[model samples]
Target: MNFKKIMQKSMGFYFNFLSFVNPKKLKKDGFELFCNPFARKVKPHQLEFLQKGISDVLDLEGYQIQTYKWGSGSKHILLVHGWASHSFRWKNYIEHLIKNDFTVYALDAPAHGLSSGKSIHVVLYAKVINAFLELHSEIKSIVSHSIGGFATTYFLDQYKEHTIEKVVIMGAPGEASDFFDFYKETLGLTTKSLNLIIDEFYSQLGKLPSYFSSAKFAESIMVPALIVHDKNDLATNYYYSIRLNKHWKNSELILTEGLGHDLKSKELVKQVTEFVLN
Candidate 1:
């Protein structure tokens, strides 16, 4: 077998074997690993382009998150990147927002970019956004990619006082349960292990993953939203965006052909700028 298959088999064996010896401990450990995965390392070259921004770190709860501020405009916009992503991923969007006379703020989630952590999840990711909003309440719009999109909705659902005028969710999963399923499948988690992990998650988070649906969160948000999903996206299904658009009362859905997950299209960028500003 190849490396991936071998690793999957090894994980299955390890979890199954541990279930007999110490199931409780295995559940706890597995849940932690499932939730707090090792962050993808940021490359050195990525930092070279970030030299123009004002950078700072925020110590929140158990995480030290890195944030960047660009532009001097009074009105502010926030850019949120997805899993395994850093603030630098917003380079293109930042330029557009700046050109439109909006100050841009981007953050490296806990365990991402310059942040100090081993693992991160949507709940913690939402907390990071909350922390930033606490200080910069003037933020008028937020543009989020992938998991960050779901986290943004989750934050808006909880904190309604913040006056966010517009939102853009790019290539995000609709349901939190789908993500958990993907996680289980990716790690080759046994049924028992999956159940135990779910139980552990409930115990810690006070809700099942199903309760944290992005579609459900969108239902509660009254602001205008633009959801961009490429039909060929492999990581997240395009149908999820369709479902989300249906739930969001005031929203527009843009379906693209070959852009896939990471949208680098200047046309899409222009569309986003028009949607947010005009």
Candidate 2:
């Protein structure tokens, strides 16, 4: 087996062993490991775009969330990238937004990009979104990719009333529970370890993963939104966007093939700009 497979197997064995001796400790350990996302190394080109804007940091809980700003339009737009992704991923999108006379703010979610954190969860991601929203109420729209879309929808639903007028969700997963399944499969968790880890999640979040559904949240949001997904996306299935669109009364759905998860086509940029501007 390769190193990754061997590591997963070892983790499974270790967690199972701990479950027999101290399930609670096993749960704590597993939960911590599960909550943290793997940080990817920043590329030189990514750094170039990240530096194009004025930079600042927002002190959040125990982490420092890095933010970048471009343009000086009074109305602001927020760009939220996905899991293991940093603000620089939206560099091209930011260029398009700026061309439309909109100021843009891109943030490094906790544990991603230059943010200081070991890991991040959807709840914490929402907290970060809310913090920036509170600090910059001028933000009128958001463009989010992958897990970032989930966090943004959660924040909007939980807050109810907000200044946000438009949102674009691209290749976002449908439910939080799906993440647990993927995590369990990735780590090759034992049943005991999985149960313990799930229990710990409930203990901390005060609810089960089933309670956090993007489709459910979308049902209540009246803000105009554009849900874009690629039929061939391997990471997040396009079906999630279909489900979200069903309940989002004011939202539009754009399904594309061949673009895959990173639907960064100039055509998509044009559609997004038109929807948000509309």
Candidate 3:
């Protein structure tokens, strides 16, 4: 973490914290979209071309799936966006991947983009990914950022590798527990209160679900993994990615400097695409 990313992550945290206290800032993160009658980021970008392609596929179960055909080849690459972001967040990556002649799947997770949930958790995202893999058994690669990166591993833990051949987890935390802890601090909830809330959340579903830790799952991965993490990713705290790489068996790490938690660097995207294709 040089001077720039430190500053950016600091600002993002401060702003996110400010919103947590003020409630108005929560809207900035798209929390109010539940109450609003209109669509947010993912809805507007559900172009005719994308919608028509997914309509021929399996049902969303809880959310909508969008697709775009890149080339005649059958090598499919699934692209997942991060927290508070939509499939459109991968606009740059999608275009590049498409130009490279690979089938692209840019999904909108539940409660995000064009999905139907009012809110979301890592489990739900993993479920959606597994279901999609069940329907399309040719997903050759996965590229996920931040929370979605965690979901990629969660999906693996849930269904035992249905489609994904290899993956690139960019800026994803090594553990969901850390993010949950961060959520508590951001929400001003104590550990006891957080546990109570999570317990209630679990009870609503009628069961306790097992979570995936990237650090643990990395040791069990049979496929290749390349983690691209910036040293300055404050949201995830660079140590998480380092720990994952340490545990992973067939994995490589690409350490960066400028990029923070966003993981939107073109160089990182290109490297990930290359790793997947190779």
- Candidate 1 ranges beyond 4 A from true positions: none
For lDDT, the strongest prediction is: 2
lDDT of 3 by residue, 1-278 (tens): 68866654564455455444743443334222221323366454445345533433335664655434444455788888778777676777777787787778777776666566666667777888888777768887889988888888767766775767789988897765565465555445444444544454455444433354778766667778998888888877778788988887778998899877876778877888789989
lDDT of candidate 3? 0.68
User: lDDT tens string, model 2, 1-278?
Assistant: 89988998888888888889989898888888877778797888888878989999999788899999999876689999998889887877888888888899999999899999888888999999989989998999999999999899998899865789899999998887887798678777777778888899899999888998998888779998999999999999999999999989998899999998888788888998888888
Off by over 4 Å in 3: 1-58, 66-69, 201-211
Q: Rate the local accuracy (lDDT) of all candidates.
A: 0.86, 0.89, 0.68
Which residue pairs clash within candidate 2? none
Collision pairs in model 1: none
| Candidate 2: Cα lDDT at 155 | 87
Q: Which has the higher lDDT value, candidate number 1 or candidate number 3?
A: 1
lDDT of 1 by residue, 79-118 (tens): 9998778888888888887898889999998878889888
Q: Is candidate 1 or candidate 2 better by lDDT?
A: 2
List the RMSD of every prediction in angstroms.
1.4, 1.3, 7.3
